[model samples]
Target: MHVFYTPDLGDNEFYSLNEEESKHCAKVLRLSIGDKIQLIDGRGGFFEAEIISAGKRRVDLKILSRQLAYKKQYHFIHIGIAPTKNIDRLSWFLEKCTEIGIDEISTFICDRSERKILKEERLDKIITAAVKQSLKAYHPQLNNAVRYKDFIQQDFTKYNGNLFIAHCEQDSQKLFLGDLAQPNQSYLVLIGPEGDFSSEEITLAKSYGFKPITLGESRLRTETAGVAACFELNYINR
Candidate 1:
């Protein structure tokens, strides 16, 4: 079944679809009256509705049943990384990470990062598509790309979670992610770019209470590391 995300959904109600969604339902999918579809509110709410009117400009549906589905809460995994130089690769990471259940994403401009700038508008579309594709009930938060120093200084008070910085540099307390994750606690995993975080950058992270951790033995790309961290957290939680 095709899942469409509608955050405005309420209990046992009907809603008129947006222009874009209407076009897709009326023209692309050619959905007619009485056709059934699923709607997720991205807040653990799912609605089963039947199309009442499949207008080209406005598609309307009447809600038949609405149920609340519990979302993943074992841990909140936030992956902070430098966006790959290739936008496509970064987009791929966003899609896969959302599917695997990442809570938040922060992009930093590290000293060794090849790409320093990114467009949030484009990234947001990719995230939206991913959320719908995965039938997710919550949208992962995405932060704008910022300087490495500025990124580290933000108030982590919102995150009462485990903090980890995944770096390639040699560290005495390097532990695999599987060994560190604890059930039901929020987690934050930081990943660097292809060039990796500079020594000074790593030191700064450590000073800011970010624990140094290792993902695996082999070297990985920025996108790969992000996806790996996301999947690892989800797998452990599951």
Candidate 2:
């Protein structure tokens, strides 16, 4: 069954699909009236519906049933990374991470960041497509890009979980993120740019209570490191 993204789906008996989704259903899939389809509200709501009408611009469906999907047993995963020098790399990371499972993503501009500006609108589309393709019931939050200092200074008093920063700087006491992160605890990990974080930036993060951590022995690019941290968190919970 083809699943569609309909975040605003509520108590209504019938729901209309957006233009992009409608075209995919009517023209590409050739779905007709009375065909069964699945809908996700991106907040854990799932619905089984039958197409009442199929048109290129709009598709109406009569919902047959609604159910809430299983929520993540572990705490939410929040990854903050510097935008990659190449935009495609960051987009790829977003897709793969969404497929695996991520609660939130934040991009920060670091001192060594090669790319400061980001196209969040395009990134949001990539995340939406990934969620649909992976059959996720919830959509991950994508935060707007901000400077590193501003990001760290924001109030995180409500967050009662692990805070970590992954950097290339040599620190003999640094431990693997998998070892430091406990199960069923919220996590916020930071990954630096290709040029890595400046010494002063790392110092500032440490002062803010961000524990220094290591992804692995081998160094990785900004996007790779972000995905690696995300996968490690998921693996630990599983």
Candidate 3:
């Protein structure tokens, strides 16, 4: 069954599905009255519904079953990364990370960051598609671009879990993610841009208690490293 993203979802409430979603359901899928479809509110709620009215412009469904999702026993992976030099590369990272069930994402403008401004509208579309494709119930939250200093300065009080910063600086402690990460806790990892984090920026991150970690022996591109870190944490807990 094809899953649809419906933010206005509610129990026993009739929602006129969005035009694009309705078109896919009614025209593309050729679904009719009484057909079953799955709906997610992108907020940890899942619903099994049966179509009440099937139209070209809208599809109405009655909620047949509802499930309140539980938080997974895996770390809530949050990646603070430098945007890739290319917009497409950054967009690809967003899509893959969402599919792997990232909790949140924050992009920062580092001294070496080549791309600063991001297109949130397009990123939202990619996230929505990834959510549906991955069969995930909640959409990952995306934060607007923030400066490196401001981003690091924000209180990480809620993030009681471990924090890591992947840097290429010499003599920095090499952290094995296996030893640092655990299941069911919030985790944050920082990936630097093309030229890497400046020494001063690294010092600030260390002062903020973000332990320096290395991805592996071979260096990775900004986008690749971000996705790699996301999957590494996700797999460990799953």
Candidate 4:
């Protein structure tokens, strides 16, 4: 069955697809009336429905059955990193993380950040597509870009002692994230920009109880670091 994202599908017995979705469902997929398809609300709502009316402009479906919290991850993974100069790199990072199972994402402007602004709407669309591609029921929350200093100051009560920052700086004191972090807990992993974080930024993060972690021996780009950290955590939790 074809899968479609319908984030706002409330408890209505019948649902009409949006214009873009309608065209894709009817014209592109050529799904006709009585065809069955799957819908996800991106909040852990998975639904099965049969098309009642199929048209290029509109596709109406009658809800058949629904399940909540479908294939939900027990652990939460939130990665905060600096945006890449090329937005596509960030898009790549988002897509990979969403498939690997992330809970939330935030972009923070570091002292050495090359790109400070982000196309959040575009990134959101990429994430949505990734979720549907991976058949995920929960949509990852994407936060707007925030300055590094301000972001580090916010109270992460949910993550608690799981705060960590990954940097390119070669420090023997830095511990492997895999060894330091415990499993099945919420995480807040921060990755820096192309030039990595300034000494001052690292100091400030440590002041807020953010432990310094190493992704690996080799130096990595901003987006690569983000993906590495995401994979590292997910691998550990596995």
Residue-level lDDT tens digits of model 4 in 125-229? 999999999999999999999999999999998886999999877766699899988888999999888888999998899999899999788888888888888
Residues forming the 10-long window of minimal summed lDDT in candidate 4: 165-174
Span of ten consecutive residues with least summed lDDT in model 3: 68-77
Relative to the unseen true structure, what is the C-alpha lDDT of residue 201 in candidate 3, on a scale of 0 to 100? Answer: 94
lDDT of 1 at 122: 90
Give the TM-score of each candidate: 0.95, 0.96, 0.94, 0.96
Q: Report the backbone clash tally of model 4.
A: 0
238 Cα displacement, candidate 2 (Å)? 0.9
Mark the 10 consecutive residues where model 1 has the least summed lDDT: 67-76
The CA root-mean-square deviation of candidate 2, after full C-alpha superposition on the true structure, stands at 1.2
Across residues 1-238, which tens digit of lDDT does each residue of candidate 2 receive?
9989999998799899999999999999999998999998888887899999999999999999998864645578999999998999999999999999999999999998889898899999999999989988889999999999999987665457488999998887688999999888889999999999899989988888889999988989888999999999999998
lDDT of 2: 0.90
Each prediction's whole-model lDDT (CA): 0.85, 0.90, 0.86, 0.91
Give the better candidate number (1 or 2) by TM-score: 2
lDDT digits (tens) for residues 1-238 of candidate 1:
6677787776647798889888988899898898999888777787788999889999999988877864647567788989898989999999999988887899989888888889998998899889989888788899999998998887786556478899888889889988988777788888998888899988998888888888899889889988998888888888
lDDT of 3 by residue, 1-238 (tens): 8799987786655666899999999999999998898888888888888899999999988888878673544457889999888888889999999987798999999998888888888888889999988878888888999999999998886678488899888844878776788777899999999999999999999999888888788888889999989988988887
Model 4 residue 58 CA deviation (Å) reads: 1.5
RMSD of every candidate to native, in Å, equals 1.5, 1.2, 1.6, 1.1
Score candidate 3 by TM-score against the native.
0.94
